[model samples]
Target: MKIAVCGFVMGIANLIPGVSGSTIAVIMNIYERLLNAISAFAKLKPSKEDTTFLFYLGVGIVTAIFAGSLLVSLALKAIPVVTYALFLGLVLGSLSTIIKRVNKVKPTYIAAGV
Candidate 1:
């Protein structure tokens, strides 16, 4: 139940430019699990847990993407500049959330430049 809500919010975040879906997943504490689930797709068979989680998350994300697009379109028609400004704010504000999710910074990671 809760995971679905989190996924939904992540979906919305993805719709907003500059607001990374992975950043929201990290904030929701599902980034590692989500990454693992996605990455496992290359294998012949993935675990049931990964498949189930991805299924629910995928559904939530797809639904939210469609709904959010419509909402954004309406908002743009009503107030284009304000809607874009709001998205800008959302992206800027999300930086703090992203920072919190950064547990550590190592030399290796720095070298990787990610």
Candidate 2:
């Protein structure tokens, strides 16, 4: 269920200009898993189970993207402000969540870089 919802959200993000579905996935906490799966495929000897799982997951994501793009494009054309407002809220909320997860006052880490 969670995957489905995230896929739908990514689908909607991809439909909007200036919004990246990959960015949305990153903000939503699914990017690492998705990237890992992709990287696994890049290996010469990927497991059959992993390959099958990725195949199904890819189908679900593609289906969601197709449906979301069609519906959102029509709705945005009819109500631009509302659609923009909703997307803005999503992005801002995601940003706040990301910030909250960050550690503050890492002077040692900063000094190591310098």
Candidate 3:
């Protein structure tokens, strides 16, 4: 379920401009897991478990891409502000998640980074 949700978030991130699905996975702290799972294929030596796990994330990403193209884009076309709001929410959510990852998040450092 978590992997599926991450895949969905990644798909939406990709669909939206100026957003990175990889960044979302990094924030979600699943980047390493996904990297291992996906890299196996490129390396041409995938383990059975890695193949199964990636299959799930792949299904999720593909499903979201299809749904977003079909439904989300249609609605976003009709209501453009909705797209902005969704993007804002994703960015804000990602920022919050990133802050949590730090041992002691510094406002000055974050401000500088931003």
Top-lDDT structure, candidate number: 1
Q: Pick the candidate with the highest TM-score.
A: 1
Ranking by TM-score: 1, 3, 2
Cα error of candidate 2 at position 26, Å: 3.9
Candidate 3's TM-score reads: 0.76
List model 1 lDDT by residue over 1-104, tens digit each: 66677778888888888887887887788989887887887674689988889888887888888898899889999999999999999876777777555699
lDDT of 2 at 71: 81
- On lDDT, the stronger of 1 and 2 is 1
For each predicted model, how many residue pairs clash, with residues at least 3 apart or on different chains? 0, 0, 0
Cα displacement (Å) at residue 54, model 3: 1.0
Over 3-112, each residue of candidate 2 has an lDDT whose tens digit, in order, gives: 66676677767776656778777787878877777788787566775576566556657877888878888878999899889878866776566556668838785576
Q: Which 10 consecutive residues of model 3 have the lowest summed lDDT? A: 11-20
Q: Write the per-residue lDDT of candidate 3 for residues 32-111, one digit (tens) a residue.
A: 98889878888999999888778777777888898877776687789879877887887787777777777987799879
Cα lDDT over the full model 3: 0.81
Query: Candidate 1, TM-score vs. the true structure?
Result: 0.81
* Better candidate by lDDT, 1 or 3: 1
